[model samples]
Target chain A: MKRNSLHRLLSTCAAMLWASFATAEVTLNIGYLAVEQPRAAVLSNLDPIPDDDGLAGARTALQDNLVTGRFLGHGYEMTEAVVPEGDDPLATAKALLAATRFLVVDAPAEVLVQIADLPEAQGAMIFNTSSGDVALRDNACRANLFHTSPSDAMRTDALAQVLVQKRWTDLVMIAGTRPQDQAYASALRHSLTKFGLRLSAEKEWAFDADMRRSAAQEIPLFTQELGDYDALIVADELHDFGRYVLYNTWQARPVVGSEGLSAVGWSPVIEQWGAAQLQSRFEEMHGREMTSQDYAAWAALRTLGEAVTRTNASDPQTLRSYILSDEFELAGFKGRPLTFRDWNGQMRQPIAIAHPRALVAQAPLEGFLHQNNELDSLGLDRPESKCEAFE
Target chain B: MIRVATACLMFAQPVLADEIWVTNEKDNTVSVISTETLEVVQTYETGERPRGITFSRDFSRAYICASDSNAVQVMDPATGKILHDLPSGADPEQFVLHPDDRHLYIANEDDAITTVVDTETRKVVAQIDVGIEPEGMAVSPDGRIAITTSETTNMAHWIDTETQQLFANTLVDSRPRHAEFVKDGAELWVSSEIGGTITVFDTETQAEKAKFGFEVQGVHPDRVQPVGFEFAEGDTHAFVALGPSNHVAVVNADTYEVEDYILVGRRVWHMAFNRDRTQLFTTNGVSGDVTVIDVAARKAVKSIKVGRFPWGAAFRPTE
Candidate 1:
């Protein structure tokens, strides 16, 4: 009885120590605000992209992380509030703040600014999912929230880095008229100038879904000439009509922009490195493959999860400070480790360029250099952020 | 490798009194030897490079680990065709059937998952990921516990099958190779390849209980040593195959001591026991022979030259 009691005492202490070291369950909340403006709806649906299903790729990824969290002791729950196509986004956000602590808004940049100004949203984390306007990351930045998707300047720079490395010097530029669309057009020109690529010609076309019937203005300059430029760079952010610009370039050059050879956050054909398991797990959960937007959602939620894991606290103050500080480190299927850019909350990650089915190239493409990780080549860093948040 | 392998086949196939199925690599088949007649019975074809073999609890079904095929082939001891099986993921080197008989845990060498397959369903039910490149595994008598040796990580994962969680990752040798739990579920013994020592760990606390290492030169430091082992009941001893030592080391389970060494053929890889643990067999892959040892005397009674390179030795259940 004496020896048995001693053995029993030892076993109990060991079991309790093991249990305490492993049982921490973290639940991350992601709030989504949707829109249904006729013009925005037309632009989003015109490209044969399914509605209610457009964000399926990203939703699947979030769901996968949520499932992994359940068994692995980390949890994530995403709740949504829609700002129907024409409703006032400010009124919609004000009404939804009661239930949501974190917002993943898919709307225009101006509306995102309005959401940031609201007193109720001061302590909440807002993720700008839809807009790629460079202004949000620069002049109009917010201290409490973050951008999951790449900014317009970042996306254009990714392509520029690749075009410069490949020496595709001459390009035919196209444009769309949305407020952010105009920002992308200027960003593309900035890319050419920054990378020393010469622009052959610039053309403008009304944004339309039927690229084949309405792409006449884009076609004549691109398809008929077969002249000076090596590739066509189309900038149709609202409708992404650049896909039709390729093979239609009169000069017979490949196209790059919102279409062919486009650069973005994530793509389906990416299965190298340690990506296989992540890909397999996502497929197992969502019943389909992933898209670029899905990667942004994954990165956003993953960063928050990392912050919680590192700080070992769920308080908003601890998480916000970790993400804003220069001490953050995380690896989320980007082939390289990524960290927050300190000056801004934008996580520096790689940009994979591809068609719907094939990956044409990955940015930070060999020669593009950076003081830190080469992936910083795809986004704006401290020297260029112009983001005076901490300054 | 060719000539020595051919000579190994001379003593392989014939009707025998004692039934011991030996997986021969060169001949690409398993030779059946009858114990009473001390000769061959028949041969059964298995997957390429079949190395591990164990019977179901009832001793009616035999599961063979096909390292090259990356699967476990289950067959009726009387027949050779793959009647049923499940994916071993990749490069399954060895596996142990738990006492429950409901689950068969496999050690797929190239992967980190220790795949657990249900015998009745023949499907991979759960895969508990462990340290890199898990090679050998064993389950305790109660079926509530199991452990796998992770070669690259140089550790052993003590997992709770009921909870399906890796409860512990206990560090061991530079290349912790294989593990076998002693009866009563009180202790688990692990063999190290590089460290050339057997480390005994407490089952509950997983603390290093004791250690055993050989003393002779070249004998003491065996390269890629302690590949696999066989545990016997009456003697409560374990015969450890010392890979480069070309010998088998006898281990006293309770005291954690290497009591003696029995010299055998070159590159000994695995060991097995007879029905009552009175006889023993060691698969010498390089020498291409099976060394039959008399357990009581602790000596090689006879060394039978078997087909090209025998990989497995399994005994028939005593009726």
Candidate 2:
């Protein structure tokens, strides 16, 4: 009888060992690719940019995914690669892609396209977290590339909707000298035309003087020629002169577009629809306010995490297919389920129209109807994009 | 004498009918509706942005989740006066009373933690870390299991009440706003608001048993967001509040199929059943009204206007 008891104990030990193996944790490795660039000097020093703008959001999302992942016997590890200025970002992206097929990229449109075209990135899913260029979601779209950042068109459309709702039909445009500013200006022009708003006058900002010191004197005179308009649209994408243009405008009208009251992917001012919880969590982690880039990066990583949790697999191909499928819906704290546009791989979400202090409204605003999804009204709809990669 | 006669009439009927307490989120007040008269009898003040409201097992006290205030207020239901505050973690969005009658599981949305407060002692027994933006809270009938559904994490975390630790976590649809343990704790049903689906999990195995979505004939799919749900007396049917769709979906619990959709006011948030489960009162947030549903007829019989942004509803017995 003693020998029989010993055998039973040995069998129980074996069973326990097998059970542990059965429940062994599955670890997923995610890659974060950030391409450093020279940011434009801001006119105001009150709100300085953080060193870890997009990266902090990805880190927080990693922690969030682990909270849900731990209960499912899953673990996640993030690999980061910050490509310095003038360096070949494609090389870093290639290396990271070799290590992990899932990458949250904070890079420009050109670099994003380069990485997506790499042979090594065939099945890999690349999330663009920083680029807002409209062409990336239009003519230059890639099959594997998904954008969390709102396209320039989306932002402009959001602002246009607000203008239409407020009946601010006549607007003047001020285009900056920078390429990004000019791009935004063109997008603003397109949106103004689309929404039936008239551009009363348009002018390019020619002054190279320091806006911080001379904005009050230079802006009024610079904008004096534009004449009277309901609102002044400034396309200073780098925040260079937007702050100064807000109050110093020639006319006592609302200043919008890239400053004053602007359309954003996410903002700290947004507190409704359970966004306060997200903002608090982010502030607790990184002692600063969450910005638009941070929100984009967070959404990118969370998208992968959601797909992984649902599909029960970490393979890039499986996650990509699942993320693109009808089953995938990301609760982005925007009071709506953010879904990717099938034609362009752009995340369809409500853009918040706000100033620095308070949220004015969220677009796809009421009465801005669409034949399909209301969010589709803000960006490149299915019929607007030229890229056929998703097909 | 008129007051004396009314007092005598009240004394004649010692056991008054039930009262439906609805929390107005924007108004920061609780409107007490007389079930007998189907009207608001009294409105009591509450803390800022009260989202969740519940009563103790014996109906002696009520707990309100004052989300903006970040504290759970305990009130005397008899007098509608605040008695004390429970040490709820920051941003208590929703909470459930454990079957033991003394423990309250509060889902702190800001902290991503579940704060269990002992009502009698007014002390936090345990603060269990949960997923991000935890909003939904529910406890099993036997008090063995508790569920916290995190809105952002999109997962229903199953907690072991005895140890106060997460034993299992199951993935639900996007933005799970509410969870309920039904059929004597045999199954747990979670409603995903943004995903527009209800996921039911088998408690024994912690496996997803069934998942279903709602559809109204003319409503857009995006508007059909399932938020809060309540099961009928026998647990045979479920009434799910579909946010913004302005309809409540009646589902056959056993079959996991939507039997019908009863159109109500705009942005229906939550519902509470009157005594005997014959009538259900739903709080409509946008319309600032309550749609009363006759359970047997499966139709909305009345719409009573309430305060602005009515969010949560609870039935209080007057006897």
Candidate 3:
């Protein structure tokens, strides 16, 4: 081809591309509300928190959404509000609600409830992407709020199912001092009972021993009292001493719970079913591996993207109805299309069972079956849910 | 001219003395299942983490994508012995041999590049940078358009075979694990494992024609993870391996309607039809076996235990 003709072709194509970009009509704004959570006190020397954790996942989802959104003449915008410590979350949520109908919240259970109760957030749909509090799905369930974060109950059940499958029915639980740690312990106990597993003993770790300072003597004494159990389950939401309990256990047992071989929403180690792609993308964008909160935020925003694409509408009410309806299902890279449970408004997804290094397994493990959906076995099923108005 | 050539090749297809080759990912071996007996006649050790497998168009050599070894192993089909390794880049998970039988397009997952190799010379011809973790590779029937589905990018990138340039990037659902062109080459179907949807794209228009979602009673919609697909020639039905759901969705090609869900082994990955298209075999990853389906009955006829994790499969037709 001659240079003149080639230049003419390039100019024609560029003009057509520009014209196509000019015709986009729909714009969807997704708001992310999170607190700049302080780094948790860890027994290990490693830094536990990434400066931008959950927000990075949401940002990736926005880019992913825009990739498809462009073809449909839809554009996506993200609004982020990171609340500082002791600040009023209501103010941040209010500002976000005023800007967009869809909000992905990576806040605590109390903050989520507070935001959901705001009149400005009445008709808007908010996704709980961080809090794993069970009460949010129980008595505190709001009509407008949907949870992407797997509740404490879900996480415990996932671990329990894996234990039952592996025939590790005998458990020795180590509970932490924090309120959330106690709550997780309670949920684990309930999971054990439901799954027909016997809890050999429950030891209270007052968390007074900072393993970093006095681990050589204290860890040995702390884990000295133990019966013959197949697994040691630790509930340490504070990350106080869970990491230290793995190699220091008196009994030769596999440790599982918040540390060791634990159940997760997402882990960097997950490579099967095309999770490697997601991990690589997250790594390229954030310069680090994606955490559970990042995955939860991504899933929430991806759910919004799916609903909007399916319905071809940005209306919050339309999206809510579609998500609640049988037609609303979002594939969340958990080997299935995740859907919202009508009763609790909790998105049903397979929980990833992993240790710090590798994925141990996925739950709804081989034999534990449910009548409706296998994932239903992990959380509060329809018959047991106490939500006010279940569809 | 292509149609006439294809007709001649179809008529000249070899006899039914073929062997089924299953790539055992964990064991680093290939299980050769006899087509006549439906039994593993032999297992040959290959490179580490053998995944995708294919035969040259003329059936002279078998190429196996040894992902962990970061190379594609060429082996003698008759002897089941490794001959040489193709110059595959980092983590060559899946690949396809173009109809010309000359070029091999491999998805170097970790490198985020599709390495095109000249099979005859065993040389790297070209490497096109694609989306992150590019897994699935497919070449159109005409040998003109090549596609690589970038799993993380969630887009099926169409590359012009001649120019070696990506022309269109059609965004689909999440985590697209595999791509296949229909019989006529008018459409392309890309399976999104995480999204649980198989999006069909028009090859000419570069538009999404339709999307199919699988629903098996008692199986969560999210667990209906479509990974690999096999289209039965001359039939309207195509079989999709649903990961972890332990079922194969039989979808009607013309109408885009899923006709039936045939139960199979756990975590079914990829599949291949026999020379006669009478039997379809699926690699069940978790179960570590291959489920053979009788196409006429649309049922899983037998489960053959092969290896720790049987991933990809192909049939070697014997003359």
* Candidates by TM-score, descending order: 2, 3, 1
Candidate 3 share of real interface contacts:
0.39
**Model 3 agreement with the true structure over B173-233: per-residue lDDT tens digits:** 7779999898678989999887788999999998999997889897666667899998987
True contacts kept of each: 0.00, 0.77, 0.39
lDDT of 3 by residue, A120-233 (tens): 998899999898898888887999889988999999999998998899987888888888899999999889889999887889887453445555356566666776789989
Residue A326 lDDT (model 1):
57
Clashes within 3 Å, all models in order:
22, 0, 4
Q: What is candidate 2's lDDT per residue for A295-384, written digit by digit as tens? A: 999999888888878888888878887887787888888888888888888999999999989999999888888888899999788888
lDDT of 2 at A23: 50
Docking class of 2: medium
Question: Against the unseen true structure, what C-alpha lDDT does each candidate score?
Answer: 0.68, 0.87, 0.83
Cα deviation in Å at residue B11, candidate 2? 14
- Which candidate number would show the highest TM-score if scored against the true structure? 2
In the range A1-391, model 1's lDDT, one tens digit per residue, is 1222111111101112123234535556555566545655432344544353324544644544442233235555555555555456776676666555677666777888889779988888777766677777787788765787787777888898878877888777777666656788888887777778878877676645555555545576545654677777777765545555656666656778877778877777875423544565566556666656656766666666556545655566778777777556555555444566667667777777777777777776766766666666665677877778745
lDDT-wise, the better of 1 and 2 is 2
Q: Which ten residues in a row are the worst by lDDT in model 1 chain A?
A: A6-15
TM-score, cand. 2: 0.89
* Candidate 2 wrongly placed segments (more than 4 Å): A1-24, A210-213, B1-17, B294-308
